[model samples]
Target chain A: MDILTISLVISAIHLGVPIILPMLGGLVSERSGVMNIGLEGMMLGGALAAVAVTFITGNPWLGLLGAIVSGLLSGLILAILTVTLRGNQVVASTAINLIGAGITAALVPIIWGVDGTSPSVPKIPSMTIPGLSDLPVVGPLFSSLTAMDYGTFVLAIVVWWVLFRTDAGLRIRAVGESAESADAAGIAVVRTRFIAVMTSGAFAALGGAYLSIVTLDVFQASMTQGRGYLALAALVFGKWRVWPALAACIVFGLADAFALRSQIVGIGIPHELLLALPYVLALVALATFVGRTSAPAGVGKPFVRA
Target chain B: MTSTQSPPRRSRLDNELRAQLAVPSRLSAGGRGGTGFGTFLASLGGTSRSVTAKIVSFAVTIAVALIAALPIVYLSGSNAQVALQALIGGSWGSPQAVAETFVQTIPLLITGLAVALAFHGGIFNIGVEGQLIIGALAAGIVGATQHLPGSLLLLASLASGMIAGALWALIPALLKAYRGVHEVVTTIMMNYIAINISTFAVTTGGPFAAKTQPSATEKVPLDAQLPVITPGTRLHAGLFIAIAVIVILMWVLYRTPAGFRLRLMGANPQAAAATGISLPRTMITAMLGSGAIAGLAGAVQVLGVYGRYFDGFSPGYGYSAIAVALLGALSPVGIAAAALFFGTLDAGAVQLQAVAGISREMVSVVSGLVVAFVAAQPAIFRLLHHLQRTVLAGRTARRAAAPVLPPPINGDNDLISAGLDNKEVL
Candidate 1:
């Protein structure tokens, strides 16, 4: 394959990892009946935490751990507000998003004494599988990805197994579908929801850590931009399932990759138009497909015991 | 003091906290009279007792917000005292500062009402950001390129903005009402599309490029510009116009039959439908009204402040408006107050950066906290009421030997009960 196509495929996979991780996180949260629009906020906080920790410790892995911890805390906060307090889920989630953005922006200036961007930190090393290196075109594709990118692929399968093949998964699905029924069946609704939300936060944080420590190696204000929202849309478009959600994320990642590649390749299409492709497509997808798809039976409702 | 802090009193305080926590769940289950500033404002515009409730609720909200931000200030390595001083001095210390505060309040007031209005009608129209952008562009293009008399051009520009905003919102409204699509998702999509289209329009040598600044559209003709109300500040005629719009909107929402139907639809869609009110029609009307108001906010920004449509002119005014609406408790009077509060924070942002050595984005922290606290208001109010009851119980027991009349639960509840379903408020 030519350099353009080779680079395009690699970039698409790299870009897809961040979105895919979050989308999976959202799937887990939503599947357990909590609608976590706060994924954006979790990712933002995680991004900052990853950079700040990496900057301090000089270890990318430790930074990733810090990101996960922050993300999990964010999830805990959301779960408390929504599940326990029974606050409006949408409002609480929006608050999380705002808090994420605000705290990150505030800390950047305080820690780095800078605005907009953070100091560069160590990036996670890329790795290639030994046997996969022997192939021609496919070898480079498998070899070029960062470890986190490969981890994300493994995460999808792991999440699928945990979600479908385990007793915990059954309880989560049961609670998500009908909390009353789940409660009747001896499941702990609040505990299930809390776990799902926190786990979701962890996954999203991993995505965020990838952005800073694996993808770009630095944190910037509003760096995730609307990618968190994009993941939510992908979750919905994929009918809240794991595998289809992966496909949807890849498509979005491809759109992004294509947009950037087109700009570089000097394609005749307007850069603005290319830049707009992902959003416009997402809008179209939402208008047509979102209405047709069925969400969790108790997606946005706060579960209260009788 | 040690005596007052006895075990019984401590247990009572714990009881009060639990009771407060129970209020929101109770409110949610009761299906009416939910806790929100919207309900508070609805009561504020009512009888004397309700007005008092409104006042108390508003005060408590402010107190809660300040307390919430205290930790952040402490974490920032500054005492609360200095941050408070900075907040006050930066927002209202001087005439210039006050004028800037008012100027910042204009768009916020307009958009806050916009969000509040849709919210009052049971719609979560998150696309106000998109509406503002499109509306601003429409007004900017019309005002800059047109060669009509000054007054006519101004009116035309504002109208174009309203029309454009309404039109843009119409798509989501129709889809939401007819197709069962959630407005939050669709509107978010629309915001992205709007931003993209606006970005495309403002590119160098693009169709709407300005003569001097290619990244911006031409400035509105001087004749069409809003006259500055203050000498050395950005305060402009749009402030009065925005206030006027707020008043008119309040009047329409409170006094009109259409408004009654809209509220009915919001509060109980099933009942509204049973009463022959068309859900789709009411939703569309509410969405259109919201869009028009949001558009006017954008238009005023262009005509009164920027005089041109620069790329990314708004720094999330639409989003901030959500906090403003809730902070104000969703009454016209409340919205006015909320706008001023946020305007002060926004105006003070730069000063906070300079005086307290904090980031200007601290306003967002405050806004976020306000949103979170507002979400928790029912519980907060319940807690406050419980504490007051406890204190009053203790005082009456020791001092007068007189039976204390039950503290009137906020009269705000009755107003909400009469008009809205609390569940629909979110």
Candidate 2:
């Protein structure tokens, strides 16, 4: 194919990876009977943590670790509120989102002595595959892939396998489908949910770190934007499965890439309208196909011990 | 826990579930033999036990939020005492400060009510921010272009705004009611779409863009602007409108048949459906009503404050409304109070920054803390209960064996159950 096609494909994958991480995170948490609308917040927390740690340590790998730790903490907060306290998952998640936004925005000035955007920090370098770099057309794409991008791809497979193949996966699905029955069957519902949610947080934070350290190397307040919500839409579009969700993320990423490139491509549509393409598409997709897919039966409900 | 009941008599099970869920005896668990007062407060739609508990919880929530900010402030190299002083002085120290606080309160009060209404009906209308934007855009376009008399133009502008907001909400409402799509996701999507649409309308070369200000529309006609209530302060007649809306909403929520249907539908969809209520219709109406109120908030901001629609005019007032509504326990009076408190925080932020060298984003942290505390109310209640039990037990051995009270009202159960029921509809 031509350079334009190859570049578009590469852009889509790069854009898709951020969303895929969160979607996978959400998938794990939801599969274990927890509803995490706070993925956006967790992702934001991760982004900030990554940036702050990298700024202090001058190491992108350490920044990635910081993001994961931040995400896990966010997940723990959600788990405590929703699981132990039996609070409304959605409300707790909303609170998490607000706190994520507020804390990140609040700390920006404190850390960098600046507001809105942080100073640029060191970013993760892209990896070059020796054999793939020699390919004719798509070599550039392979050469441009970062470690995080490859990690995300592998992570997706691990998530899918853990969710569907292993004994732990079965327990999660069982709890999600019927927490009461799962408890009766000797599974620890609350523990399973807590772990799932924390795992979700770590994954989501990794996604946020990708934006800061891997992609931009600078953190902006609310920079995750609505990618967290878009990931939710993608999850719904994918019917709460692994492969389909990943595909859905790719579709959204493609839409995002097109919107970005369309200005240069001189599409007749206004740039403002172009920016709205992904959300519009999400709305359409949700309205049309959401009726067919079923969420885990016990999702959203607090599992109160009898 | 009650799942073992026979399926043949589902209504009875629903009744029991409603009784257990609706009456928050646990809120009054701190007081021995306080079930009567708890039931009375619950009947009056209050989320806490007595007025005392409500006040105490409110104070604690604020205090905790402030204390939580202390460490952050210290870490930021700002003096906590100075920050506190500035926050107070800016929000309530002088008449001018009070007026400014009210300025912030107006939109929050309106949007908080909009959010509370949807929450009461078991719908999470997260798109209020988007609805407000669309409303403001409509009001701006109409107020600027209309050729009618002053009063007529103002009315038309406000009406157009409400219509725009309702129309915007219609998509999510229909999708939620008919397709079982969750409004949380759909409304959020609408918010992004609204932001984009507004940006397109006001940006340079767009339809409503001002020649001098590319990111904002032309000012509305003088006649269309809200009349100032105070001579020097920016306070306007929007305060009165906000109050009037609150009174009307309270009546609608507590005294009307439609309101009863809404509450019933929220409390238990099965029971509501059994009582001949149309679930989808009620959901659609509640969502539309929420959107209209949210729209009015935007219009009021345009006419009363800015006098024109500007890009990014709202600093997430819609999202903040959720915290306000929850903190207010979804009650109109409570929401008004909560909005006033949040308004104080917002108004004080500027002074906090000027005097204490702190960032205005500090207010967001406080608000976030408040919401987090509110979300964990059950745990707070339990902690209070445990403390009370220990103290009471120490005072008298006889009271030590008293059984645990029932759980506090899970305010979000209606939302979860409503979502579940909606999915089962199609």
Candidate 3:
């Protein structure tokens, strides 16, 4: 293939990382019977935390850690509201989104003494595969892959294995399918859901970190920019499975990459229209596949013990 | 019960439980004419008590929100007292400040009502933001180009806005009603699409772009603008329109059979469906109604405040409207009050920043906290109930002697019973 084709393919993989991570996160949470629409908020929180920590400590790894920690905290809040308090999942998630946006926007100025965008922070360096670097056209693509890009693929496999293969995974799917049956089977429903949701937060935060630390090297207010929602769309598109979801994310990523490059490619379409491509695709996907792809039966319903 | 039967069966059980708990007293009163007036008075008393409880709930939510914001305020290195003073003084300090606050209140109030209306019908219309944008674009285009008489032009612009908004909402409404697609995701996606469409419309060389201005439409004609009702303030005729909408909405929701059907659908979809109410029809109507109100909010903004549609003119009024609707407990009067409070906070943000060295986003934090608290209100009520059981032990006799209150119309009991039936089904 030509350089342009190879580069486009590589860029699609890179752009897909953020969406892949959060889609996996949402997949896990939903599988355990909790709908997490707050992925957007968690991603934003993680992005801000990554930027702030990298700026403060001058270490990209520490920044990634900060992002994970912030995500876990957000997850904890969600678990408390949806699990313990039995609140409306949608309303609670909306609050989480608001808090995430508000707190991040408010703290940005205090931390960096700036509005909107934070200063550039230390970035995680990309690693080249030794043998792959020596190959022909496709080598450059593998050569420039970041830790996150590889981790995303590896994590998807791991999540799939854990969710489908393990005893714990059985418990999670059981709880999600029917919380009462799972409870009767002696699985700790609340605890499983809590852990799944928190895990989702951590994964989603990593996605946010990929944006700030791995890709951009800086944080901007509301940087996630509905990528989290796209992740959700991808999750639905994938029908809540691992590999299918990964493919869906890559497709979305390809659309995003194409949109970004369309202006430079001098496509006749307006840039705004190009930018709207992924969302429009998501809408179509939702419209086409909604009832066909069943969500977890117990999702979005707060568990209240009799 | 089998897995496939869970939702419908559970909802039926919920209705049965509600009927058992709430119908007996009313039925007893109906059977006894001599005691009917006394029961009516008792029901009235119960309503007043519930109202008091609702007020307490709102107060608790605000209190929790302020407390949650305290840490953020301190971390930002701002004095709490100074922030408080700035917040109050800026929003209500002068006649001008009050006017500005009212101006802010207009869109929020209208959008809040829109959200509340949809939410009341079990629709989560998160796309209000997008609907408002489309409404503003339509209103802006008409107001700028139309050459009709003054009143006619204004009416035309507003009507165009409502039409655009309802049309924008039509896709989601149909998808939801027919395909059972969740409106939350679809509506949010629509929001992005709307934003892109609006940006395209007003871009440098796009259709609605002004000759001189960049990324904005031409100035709206004076004939289409909402006249300022107060001579010394920015308060426009839109305020009266908003009030009229509210009054009309309240009447529709409480006094009309159509409203009763809508409420029944929201509170108990299965039951409503069983009663031969067209679920899809009501869902479509509710969403369209909501979108229209959201559009009217946008039209008012353009006609009263901006005089034209500017790209990215809204500072998240639609998103904040969710909080306003919830905080107001979804009542028309309550929504107005909540909008006023939010309007004050929005208007105060500038002064808070200038005087207290705090970011205006602090308002968002407070609003988020308020929403969180509202979402967790059941927990709060549970806690309050526990405290009352323990602390007000001596009042148990009086409570027992009191008449039984009607079942809560908000569907919380439905959720509880639904949860209970899950076990039985399993």
Candidate 4:
């Protein structure tokens, strides 16, 4: 294949990394009967926490840890509101996003005493498996893959296994399908839901950390830039399954990568119009195919035990 | 211990489930078994109980919001007392402050009502932000021209804005009403598209780019500008228009048959469909109406405040409108109060930054906390009901032990039977 083609493929995978992580997070949460519309908020929290920690501690790994913890806390808030308090899931999720936006905006100035963005921080180094790195045409992509890219691929398989192959998966599916029946079966429905949502937080935060520590290495306001919503559209496009959702993320990522390259390569299209491609595609996909896609029965419904 | 502990918990769970289960005795649960005052309140209007409930919910939400900001105040190392005082005094201190708050409130009130209307009809029109942008662009383009007379110019500008907003909103409305797509996702997409188009339009070398500003459209003609209400403050004629719109909305919602259909469709779609109401038609109309209102907000902002279209003119008015609608309990009167409150915070932010050493972002946190608290109203109600029942349990213990209950449950059963019998008409 041509060098340009190989380069395009590499950029697409790299772009897909952030989206794929969040899509997987959304999948786990939705599959367990909670609609995690707060993926965006969790990612924002994670991104800020990750970058802020790396800036303070000078340790990228510790930054990742901070991202995960903050993301989990954000999800826990969503879980408590939607599950325990029976708040409207959509409203609660929107609140989470606003909170994330607000806190980050306030903290940026507080921490850096500057405006709009943070100073650059430590970033994760790319690694390549020895044999894979030696391939002819695809070698560059493989050799340049960050730890995040490999972890995303491995975690996708792990999530699929845990969701489809394990007994715990059965309980989750059972509760999501019919909470009353799950409760009748002694499945501890609320507990399972809490775990699912928190796990979702962990994955989504990893995606945020990937954006900050691996891709950008700096924290900026609104840095996620609607990727969380695109991840949601992917979950819908992928019919809420792990592998298909990841594939959808790749398609979206390709669009993003193409948009980026098109601007650099002097494509005739207007830059603003080019930036709008993923959102437009998401709308088209949703309008055309969302009806055919089935969601979990208990998704978005607060399960009240009688 | 287990017996006493478990029973209260179980009873509380039952109380929580009662409303969701559509229990026949729901009204009495709110009214405390129909004391004379409870019955009077229940009979005053179909929604009177809900009105009271909304008031209580909003009060609690505000209290929670104030408390929620304390941690931030501590983190910022500012005096909590001074910060709180500044927040209140800055928003409402002087005549100038009040006028500035109204300046912010005018556009917000219109958008908030726009959102509340769509939500009332079970449509989540999250594209208000996008619609507003397109509306503002239309208004700006029209207002910049000098082809028409004074009144005509103003009318044309505002009409163009409304038309543009409706057209922009129509895409998601059509998809949602006919294609069974979720409006939330579709509208979010539209917002990005609107932002892109608006940005492109105002950028250098773009169609509407100002020769002077380079990044904004030319200023609107003087004739098309909304008249100022105060000499020095930013207050304008848009406040009167917003008030007029609110009155009209209230009249339409309560006095017109169309409004009843909208509310009925929202509350129970199955009943609405069975009664021959077309879901698609109602949804489309609601969306269009919502779009027009949102469009007016944009036009008002441009004509009254900016006099031109600039890139990123809105500070997420559309997103903030959702919280406004919720905090206001989706009522016109409630929305006015809520908008004024938010307007105060928005206008006061500048002063707040100067005096209290707090960021304007605190208002966003406070608004978000209000939404969180308001959305949890049902849980609060459940807990309140549990407490009320527990307090009354001892006095009515022997009477409650009897199988037959008093008038409230029996009256509710009768009412439920009547409702079920004529469910189709309802």
Clashing pairs in 2: none
TM-score of each: 0.89, 0.90, 0.90, 0.90
lDDT of 4 by residue, B93-119 (tens): 898888888998887799999988887
- Error (Å) of candidate 4 at residue B426 is 26
Predicted candidate 2 versus true structure: per-residue lDDT over B1-426, tens digit per residue: 122432434434434435534433334223211222122223223322444556666778888988987877787787778888999999999999999999999999999999988877677899999999999999999998878999999999898988999899999999978887778889999999999999999988888899997789899988779999998999999999899989999878765677767766665455456678898999899999999999999999999999999999999999999888877777798889899999998999999888887888877777788888876776556566567656666656555555443222322244322222111100
List the pairs of residues colliding in candidate 1.
B37-B329, B38-B329
User: lDDT of candidate 3?
Assistant: 0.81
Worst 10 residues of 1 chain B by lDDT: B417-426
Q: What would the per-residue lDDT of candidate 4 be over residues A1-306, giving only the tens digit for each residue?
A: 977988898888888989998899988888888877778878888999999989989999899999999988988898898788866677777788777777777777778877668999989888887998788888888788888888899999998999899999889888877778899999998999899988888888888888889988888877887788889889988888888788878988898889899888988887777788888888888887667447776776667777
TM-score of chain B of 3: 0.83
Candidate 1 displacement at residue A198 in angstroms: 1.3
Q: Ranking by lDDT, best first?
A: 2, 3, 1, 4
Candidate 4 lDDT at B211 equals 94
By summed lDDT, the worst window of 10 consecutive residues in model 1 chain A runs over: A285-294
Better of 3 and 4 by lDDT: 3
Poorest 10 consecutive residues by lDDT, candidate 3 chain B: B38-47
DockQ, computed on Cα atoms, for candidate 3: 0.54
